[model samples]
Target: MNTETTNTERSTQIMHTEKQIEFDKIKNIWKNLAITDYAKECIQNTEICLDEVELRNRLRDTTNSKEMIEKLGTPPFQNITEIRDIMAIGQKGDCLTPYQLERVERVLVVVERLRDYLSRGKQFYNSLAYYDENLDALPELREEINMKIRNDGVDDRATDRLFDIRSKMISVEESMKQKAEQTIRNNKECMADTYYTLRNGRVCVPVKKDYRYKIQGSVIDKSSTGSTYFVEPAGVAKQYEELALLKIEEENEVYNILYTLTAMVIYAIPVMEENMRMIEKLDFIFSKGKLSVDLDCVEPQINLERKIELTKARHPLMDKSISVPLDFKIGETERGIVITGPNTGGKTVAIKTVMLNAYMAQCGLHVSCKAANISMNSNYLCDIGDGQNISENLSTYSAHIKNVLEILKEVNKDSFVIMDELGSGTDPAEGMGIATAILEELRKSNANFLVTTHYPEVKEYADKTEGIINARMTFDKETLKPTYRMVIGEAGESCAFYIADRLGMPKEMLENAVTAAYGKGAISNYKFKNDNLKKKEVKNVIIKKRKYHKDTKLSTLYTIGDSVMVFPDKKIGIVCEPVNEKGVLRVQVADKKIYINHKRVKLLVKSEELYPEDYDFSIVFDSVENRKIKHDLDRKYTDEVYHYDIEK
Candidate 1:
């Protein structure tokens, strides 16, 4: 029951599978639910567990987290990026800043709160409590960090020398300020601006430049023009020197305190790392539980018997209000399902739903379903959309055939494969032939598979083959629309004639299409009424041709493709569609085609005189982009067209 893959090979396959099923969209949802970037990374890097024990443990943890969240509120694991960055710096033998030490204490406090929160329900939520034990709050270090650092600075209580030095600084600073004020009062006449100011952390008095040496110990500062000078008296100078020495002592003591705190943080780094990992694991588990709740998902039964039964399963990525729920099964008497339906039906979605649920279940996530029973698979292989690679020079058919060949090589009973519109993008007869052959091979391999196709021949093969079931997305014949509801054990008709008739195609054309498809009306033509179209109908009538009024009508004056200038507007245009007998000529002006009386327009150039005998006028009439796209399709096959919905 162990299916764990190893190293780069497994990683490549996991990413490939994710791309095929668009698992990143679901992964995005899971990542956003997490509180911390660490938990988001855990979701981004995790792969599906194929081993029974590993898979079950993941599911069990998620289940326990969900129950714990509902009963005991969410665990408080706040996002703490600073904790990791500071720890890294501490590891490099660098002393942490006071701010970083404070952040460390904050994280530790949260860890302690989370630990106590989970421990309360240990007897009932033991699985959740396991992670709680891994969270080492380190209360002793937490208390130490908080006590030493307060408000992003070393507190006085941090060290006795720091306290004593700071007290001395305050007293020296007061005494220096008093001495500065007294000197300013005595030298009022010699002062330049009459103020005592601090320069380089020393008290100085502004003095007139002419009286610089009158009362001074040292010049501390001067004005830009040399009109004024600053001096500190010798009496205050000695006391100022003592104050500076005490300030240096205070700085040294603060550095010592910070060094000791940094060492303590470094010592606790290992335990903090363990605590972070535990928090991330818990965050990741809670995110899964939150997704289950947000999507209203259910945890399904898992077994190793290769049997999958889903009742009312939904595609998690789709809008539940509009999308139809799928009811499907496989890996039992029938290991393969061949889905046949009209284009744009829910065939591809239904197949993807089955594969996505199995993939999620293997990842230990809940399935978006009312209820289900699923099995572990060694691999989830799929080729759901067009795999065309222009750089690789692979056509749609070539890409599909290559993917099928690779799938054939890897599939076994323990594998689950979903193929959408297989054997498409090629000749219908050849595609159906290959589709049937691949289905037969899959049946023989005993691998559970779901494939959708529009080929009737493949449907017939599924109908007659043993251990293969035929399903179809239901169609409404009256409305000519697909119901998008899958019905098992039924072969669906293409209903091409019904759809054509509904779209206003002539009855004769529908009959011709029916004859060509079913061999001369092998099946009855669908019944449709012209009256049900609910529009006005004209009855057949005959009339004589209009009599010529020679004087009343304007004579034809321009040939088709001749450029003409219309009167009044002075706009030039190209003449198109020949001038009618009544002298009304069709002309193209820019992108619009207009009809004007020939008398109001005069030909500027003759069709024969402009260029050659048979020039293509559409070059001027058609857009440049359209001409370019047409040229591309003419040279080689391509799906890109200027306006596909209009032209085709």
Candidate 2:
């Protein structure tokens, strides 16, 4: 295989397939099982591996870890995941703080323990013991660090120079105390206290404020109340200065000791860093084992041939009790399966389970199944879910179309693809056409895939195609619920009519719906029965009429009798019609009834305020001759009425 091409394809697959299969969720599970931050980071950056030897090696290590834990108990893997920065500090020529050095010591201790643990069972765990060869014990550095450092500070015996400096400072401090005692006794009457105390790193005797000037010493610090002063005895003043010098020397020696230890650590930085990496790798390996035990997983039989056969496979995220176990296969005879089922019938879950299992197995983790005979693929591409991009103003169907187009561009025989609800979220006729054409194109690509659809025509195409098979999520008509079982070599009913019938929809309407779906004669041939159970059956019942309170009052001034001015025409006319749903209105403009939009007509006057109650608008709207013809028609029959209507 071309390395560049294979890497490019895997990158694309990781970009698109993670969220669709919730692979990150599985990673979170792995992360939680890990004892070290190193392992967690390793898990986060893991790629879906397809290399046969590399994948087998990782799985073998994981299996070894699982057995090692079962027989020998948990390996003493410390949570010293923060060793990277500690090593970086030493490598950058900075002295490691006592705390940070202890962390490095911790890493070394864990390495030693793991080696010993694996060695004790070397006869039984030869593979596990193989890591001991590359691992350098680095006993000199470990022992030096352990001896020189404490939890909080460097030990006094860390260096001979530091030890001598501290010893001389102690002797000088004792001599200063003896001299201060003599001065306090000679000036007992002037002393504020009998004991000598420390003041500015010098032994001092507290004196009364009035007698501070009389004391044979220099005042260093005074009490807050100003009644007493801390004075250094003049005899010990020179000795205090000498002890201070020794203290400075002590600091320099301590730094020298720390620097020497850090130099040794820096020399071994390369080894320790490599050791840290190995420890992290071992942590990740054991974590995979822990996840295997938690998920009750089995090693999948990875094959070079692109065939998938899984038995009793459950989605790793779902509860096993509630989730239906899937037995699915492809690439043996059929290259693709067209799944047809009603809504929420596990069609989506069915495909997702198969895809996620194949993904996990390829990554060298045990799959959650009794048996997973899987194949390695260059990439697994799926265009599942709505993924509606609201910010970009893309609809569900538009998103699906975009994703499917992108998937189609990168599909191949080594590619495992899954598409759900193909040709949905659009006009049925056009969507079905686009779906069929896309399927044919996919067939040409020879990619092993699974497609779910509600289009009956797609089902027919699957039945006739040689490399395609028809599958369905079984539904129970009697219970009006889905069984959530996948059956091969059969097509499924949408069960819309049965569900509607059970929901109290009239039988005639369901029959009409069937007719509309499959055309006129399909209703008689449709297989469904009306539930006659009186308690559960739908019954015709009279509904009570209601008038809800209206919240919005009309603001428009167009009334039947109101005078309105027509725009551009500038003719005054009585409003003869109310605004319709289209906002069109009728206005009698001088016996020529004009049809115009409401926007063109404006209210000129209020009829209720001007016209009297029960007023006859004929005086304002009709001519005298036309009124006489209307009065004649109301009292007696006449052909003159036709002339009146035609003239009006």
Candidate 3:
């Protein structure tokens, strides 16, 4: 029997990654838990002389049945007697002693002889009673013999011979098994029902309840009542007395056996520890299972429900209690989101939500999503929040610039990038100008990027430029707390005066500050500029890029004229289009249509058109090989290149 299949796989299959960690934590807390499992395995593996449940009963045998219930919680079996009759002695509330067991053994010898004689006669007696046509008792043979001899009133030789045989049987009867006879050599009839012996060649018989008569003998004893007798034959009487003590000795041996068995309970301590550890792990897994986020809306659906999916993703440090569930998918034509919101509005969490979920999915735990449908870039670049290095005496704006510079060096056309607080910690004019410039460079670089910023200038860039969009986190002035919700196509309203007034600032001072900054016209100009930027919206380049991508794919598919898969990142397609060159189908794809690979493509045919052995559908990806290439400047950048060739 493969215990491994049921016991090992079942125990491990219930655990997720987090649950495994939880189990480790529990082991640290209680080391003995591992031992508990080992103990259980030991019991299970022990030789089963009895049935499993019966063996369990024997192992738990005890004199005090009440203590059994208290300690083990439940008896391993219903009644210990079901496994053996010894349990009955315990039920009588009198513990068996060794002396009693020895006595029983001696008594059983006599019982055994009687049982053997009856066994031999049983078949014949049963046949006479059941097999005959007329079942009747045997005729009176003794009376017939006596009557025959008496009726003749003569000296009958045959009658005389029978009487002689009967008288000799009492004096000369013997057993062939001398050893068995010797064990019961001291023959005593203490009573018609009970027997007792003494050293004085005396035996007592109890003829009436609680009344006894003694018999004394020279080599043999006769009762005073003459109803029962005894025999004393030297050492035989002492041997017989020892036989009577056998039952008690055996009972004591049984108690010793059980005492040794109970010592094995020490092994159970570890088993309980291990069980407790596993229990705690189970608790943690179930606790995570209890999270009820709005993941249903993000369930992966085929083409019609196509969207970016970030399942059960969260800010790694935020406790589960304060965590907010954020879900959004860009509709068709809504790429390049611009998140604009007040401070502490969960902007950072939202950004991390996207990044960490992608990382987690790559590592292969089923994402926290009800369903996940995602289109991913082959590469990713992140320019998240960075604080200025005081040791270098660098300002925040300088640090931000250095981070963006590093980001620009690595980003490619097929990369996804996230930038937090895109322009900040510098002169307002300079920061806004640099922010718009960076967006322009990113747009031309052909990378999908997300940027968060407070600058109105950055928002204006989104409205005026193609392949860009604006978004904002919602705020409630009445509550003065961020709702942590995003609304697309809107810029965050900076309500400085309103907040100052709510915070118990003098109303007159707030009014004066607002008038000094705005003069009513500055505020009007702000709205006008925003409205103008919306009017100046240009054709989004991402829409054009998607259209071109769709066209390229359609063209390649058309050329092949048969079903195939496209690796868009590498701009390659494996065609079933047969050609004379090497007599193999040519893989044709475009370099500009980046990321399509031969590994991504497959030969498709109707099931009825192929046999099981006809085709191998497994696709193998090529290992990247470094190739040094010459540039116009005679300098070379070592490029890791990959190419595919059909094996069959």
Summed backbone clashes in each candidate are 0, 0, 40
What value of lDDT does candidate 3 attain over all alpha carbons?
0.43
Q: Tens-digit lDDT track for model 2 on 105-125?
A: 778888888888777657785
lDDT over C-alpha atoms for residue 283 of model 2 = 81
- Per-residue lDDT of 101 in model 2: 78
Per residue, candidate 3 scores C-alpha lDDT tens digits across 535-619 of 3333321100011253343333322333333422323243434333232344544321222323234433322233244443322
TM-scores for candidates 1 onward, in order? 0.77, 0.75, 0.35
The TM-score obtained by model 3 is: 0.35
All candidates: CA RMSD (Å): 15.9, 13.3, 29.7
Q: What is the overall TM-score of model 2 with all chains considered together?
A: 0.75
* Consecutive 10-residue window with the lowest summed lDDT within model 2: 539-548
Query: Better model by lDDT, 2 or 3?
Result: 2
Please, what are the lDDT tens digits per residue for candidate 1 over residues 463-558? 999989999899888877777889888987787777777788765555544543444445364675442444444442221122236664444456
Clash pairs, candidate 2, are none
Q: State residue 158's C-alpha deviation in candidate 3, in Å.
A: 69
Worst 10 residues of 3 by lDDT: 75-84
Error of 3 at 640 (Å): 77
Q: By lDDT, who's the top model here? A: 2
Best by TM-score: 1
